[model samples]
Target: MSTDNKVPEIRSKGFSGEWAEEILGDVAEIKTGPFGSTLHAKAYVEDGHAIITTEHFKSGELPVDKKNIPQVSEDDYLRLKAYLLKVGDIVFSRVGSVDINALVTNKQEGWLFSGRVLRVRSGKIIDSEYLHHELSTSRVKKSVVSRAVGQTMPSINTEILKITPIHFPLDTTEQTTIGNYFQKIDALINQHQQKHDNLSNIKKAMLEKMFPKQGETIPEIRFKGFSGEWKNLTLGDLGSVAMNKRIFKHQTTISGEIPFFKIGTFGKQADAFISKNLFDEYKAKYPYPVAGDLLLSASGSIGRVVEYKGEEQYFQDSNIVWLKHDGKIDNAFLKVFYSMVKWSGLEGSTIQRLYNKNILDTEISTPERQEQTAIGNYFQKLDNLINQHQQQITKLNNIKQACLSKMFV
Candidate 1:
């Protein structure tokens, strides 16, 4: 497992970092996508030929969902079959979310291409998978992002794509080996991602059952013989929303401290992370969220809720609202309630704007303090399990990436 051994370093140029040249155009025949109306999907029919587009490509592989393959008549296939996709053909997104790449794996014989994507076919000098990996690397991604020309939605044309420089091993066998290795890694990452998604669904189901419905006083399941009606309350009556006023100019030096979370960090479950430092010299200007404060994203990505676990060292000023609960209301209960509100579409602007006042006005039904504790504790355990699985998936993906970087070279 140790990657300590030094491997061969191949420069793009023939010389050692002095006369670097472009790897793509030299090794592949890059073709601009068809622009004429000859490739329209209306020409396709049921049981039609497979058609590829930017939408079909996801995370370096073709996604099965959202597939839009159209059936081309035998006559039409003759006119357009040249653009039909084959195994090993590398597809690249040329427009929105530019530079996304996918390798064709499904061997089913009839696949076509759309105008939004480009096909990169290799010459005798290069392997298709190797070139695909080169296009997908972080270095290449940066280059592609830089080379993309448009101001609003940047994109790279086929000509620019052909000249895009890529670094790779000179040996063909090594190239194929590296390509195949990363392919396996990509598959594993997708698998873990799917499992993570399933676990999340399970947690959501558990939450729905644990919490009472709107205006319902008693939960479907109660502890032992205990039974009590939950109370209805307005968020403003239970707690007050506080906005952070401080701002941080620099985020680079703030790493090991607490992360200041903007509304962007809020997710369906909790705030993704904490801020480490505050830029505003006035320390008390922004509301400080302690271990029990409920953090809600008040703007963009509305309705994300997270309980402060004392992990973040700091916070920032953005579209964020902090809810400090009164002693009568449990913080955990508030967290669950916020989650329920989000699920019910109660908070956030009437027009999708997220603000503190919108959340304050949200109506909530709450059980007694003891019952709230029980429900919160139940969901907390479930959330912990989901987090554990997520951590494992992260470790596995990191291992895959390391293997990719080392095995390729």
Candidate 2:
């Protein structure tokens, strides 16, 4: 669309605020980041100052405990003082993963700017917080990114940013009002996120207490005490543990009668994949998983177990293992147990990878059937509550995104 035609005409409909267009006049100065190579942690060594980067800019706030934030010496600070970010200045990412902008709040007071970010300073024409929102809006991000030029790593230089059009209310009071309005919403979102994190930590602690360590068993419940000790069993002793047989490459078809699962699908709580209608008949000859069977990843993210609750599904040749436990083992208990073990000592190509032999040889202290049921039920209830809170967080975030899209342009 042409720039003149695509410009968002100021709407006087429901808003009491006055809309105005400022030609991004010369009142504001744009500063590109320096070419300093100071590592993030080095930026804050002895009596060091905080540094802001694309990673530090979170939902409207800069996190203080950032891992890679660079520190600067007094001499370096003096040399770069002109480019140092001040409170209310807006810092944005110009290189990779562009469009992350955050207003420098009091939390970042005295922090130095990093080479990977650009700083925008306006002399009273715009509220930094408001401008931060404007710059980060999806409309502006899309328009500005389209103007970026690069083949390997894209970048928006300072000269390009100087001409980036910004819309604002003509009155400063209106600008502050709108900025504060969104700030409150952002704060609420942060609060909810922190609560979610706390609940997750609590769940982790509970899991440690509920499960027995190696060579340990649950003490007899005073109410329903049992005389027998819990058994130490290897996974191989529990059931038929086998990796899926690979289908011949030539025989494989895109759409088949059976749904093939990759490690990604298993990571999600899904159990089945429908054939895409392109698979050859011979490729569907492997053993299919039935409902209630426990599916585990043997390689690449080993020991992630999910109970198959779907109608039917076929496993892929990826690092996944299927365990069809006999009636003696409760799948629910194993699922929770696998998650609690922390999967330590299991090595893979990446941090999430796991090996089948290591997991199979790892011993688990299995309680009697009755005790297993109690432990599973307790953790399940807690997990269900966490899921509900997570759903709420998702809904709130979606609402925020929608509001931002409509309110901006």
Candidate 3:
């Protein structure tokens, strides 16, 4: 990332020399979209030619589905033929996010772009895919931002884009290799993203159907070999609310032996810390949460839950609290139930805080321990898959960014 030269610091094996550079105007044809008056919103129809707005430009391939896209008549499509998008065209945002652009594929051919878009058609000397990747580099992005005008809303024009500088390998084979490499990475990222989204949707549907609705004794859906009605109980019947002993502001430090989590940092990284001695002393004297205990955020964002996991950490008292429960109810089952639990007195409250009384009085329905374990284990596995895919997506994105930084001049 620190390197800045005509050729990439990291590249495919063999055949390398300093890359060639030229203004975009010298290697491509730059054109702006049709004026707003030329294509009015009223001219749009239900089924016809699709238009490409800034909204349709995405990090992945353009969606082929025409469900929600606005369209125009055949006559209008021909009238704006100059603005028609072709395969391999690169479309850039003319205003905000002027640095982001989408490369046209076969899916987007024959579409018209809005006035807020700028199109770059590669000439015979340049490869469009290579140009797209080069434009995505941090160095070129910074250049575009530096030349952008307007304080409140940065904007770019055809003249500005035409003069933008880009560097690429002299060999077309090298350009294709780099472009295909990034394309495969993008495909993997998109695949994981799709799975993550699908699993999330399935989880949401299962949560609603697996749990009983109001005034019902049995859930709409349940595992076989479990027939009896579930028991109706209040949270107070299971446990009492407990919290850590109060730690004053002076007890905390920016960096120390153990992390101290406030309501804001309940499920995230801690910005404050306390000495190990203080943490140990406070934990011993207070009603501390055991491993697998569910910690709830009572203020700010009400009812947010996290498992303690037995980490060496302290949380803000009162604002964050947990239930000190007997061994009857399973923590795994309770964790999933928390997603569906509605705290009493939350409705029609002006302050929007979850008081201890509301949690104690909240109603719940539960089956026997064996059934509880079965249901909890099933959902937990699903959760594991979802988290694994999320982590993969994040890691792949990081790798892509690093490559983009070093693979280009």
Candidate 4:
């Protein structure tokens, strides 16, 4: 992060060009929007000439949606023409601990900016995209924020942003290359994120349509060939609920033969461990989750469910509850059902929690065994797709972060 003359640790192939360290004001024109008093809340409309505020560009780029933005009158827009955004203007949040930014494109041109944002316009000497990314870097932010803090808000002002150091490549070609590279990376990330969100929303909608609502005997929608009313019963009727073996904090280890899980590790890796001897002793007396058993987090993050894969792991008793379902209920069907389950009639005392009795008393609707299996399998495949999309997004973000760190000074 130091502003040193040494070259970046990583760079694109065929490029080892030296970077130029220059104060931001020297390379770009800086200005802010009209003040708050000039654009009062009373003038805002639900739909009109859109105004971009600090909230609009929280992620360092302009969001596409304009109709959601608060709007001003025609007179107000003309009066604030000086503050209107033009294509290629990089916008920064003038207030906040985080340095949020955005690049104005043709789609954003002519939109009025709120008083809390600063507009930075780079000349031909600097690449607009590259400068936007540079301003977004954590290193420069750490250095500049020291001089920009305000009394009431964690903020940066025009004076400090003007002189903020911009570490940039001397080669405009390299700058463009880096800029375009990140643009593509961002596009891919957005693409995968959209797919993930769509899948999640689809599953949610399907759950509502496929499951019977309160006081109803049958769901409004069902798979083809599925007919007749679903049978209703309390959760206790479908499965024998059980709790995990009690393992006190001091009794656990940082590492051992059996992986030990607390609430935090319900669907993740075990954080602690128990010895094989201790695990076996409890296995004979206490119940442990096996294949097909559904584990539910019963603590602060209540009702988070995970089906056991029969892994060699121990679960904490106080924070976790397990469901040992009989052959009457399909494990996969129950897994999908839990995600849509809304536990009712529980009193909100301290923290919201689901007790063993609460779980037993909750109502459930079930179809025939074969129909349950088919629905469960369909949902399982959908879930796998969601996971794969999520993993791709994570992997892409990691790559992007590494590139940002290594490609910049």
Show how many residue pairs clash in every candidate, following the order shown. 17, 14, 0, 1
* lDDT of candidate 1 over 25-54, digit per residue (tens): 787776655665766666766664566677
Where is model 4 more than 4 Å wrong at Cα? 1-4, 150-152, 345-350
Q: TM-score: which is higher, 2 or 3?
A: 3
RMSD of each: 7.2, 5.5, 2.8, 2.2
Flag the better candidate by lDDT, 3 or 4.
3
lDDT (Cα, 0-100) at 171 in candidate 4:
87
Best-to-worst ranking by lDDT: 3, 4, 2, 1
**Stretches of candidate 2 exceeding 4 Å from the true structure:** 1-19, 22-27, 33-47, 58-61, 65-68, 72-84, 205-231, 242-292, 298-304, 310-321, 340-359
TM-score of each: 0.67, 0.73, 0.89, 0.93
What would the TM-score be for candidate 4 when compared with the true structure?
A: 0.93
Q: Write the per-residue lDDT of candidate 2 for residues 136-180, one digit (tens) a residue.
A: 778777767887778787787787777777777656665676678
Angstrom error at residue 4, model 2: 7.5
lDDT of 3 by residue, 281-300 (tens): 88888889999899998886
The C-alpha local distance difference test score for the whole of candidate 4 amounts to: 0.83
Error of 4 at 223 (Å): 1.1
Model 1 clashes, total count: 17
- The candidate, 1 or 4, that scores higher on lDDT is 4
lDDT of 2 at 381: 76
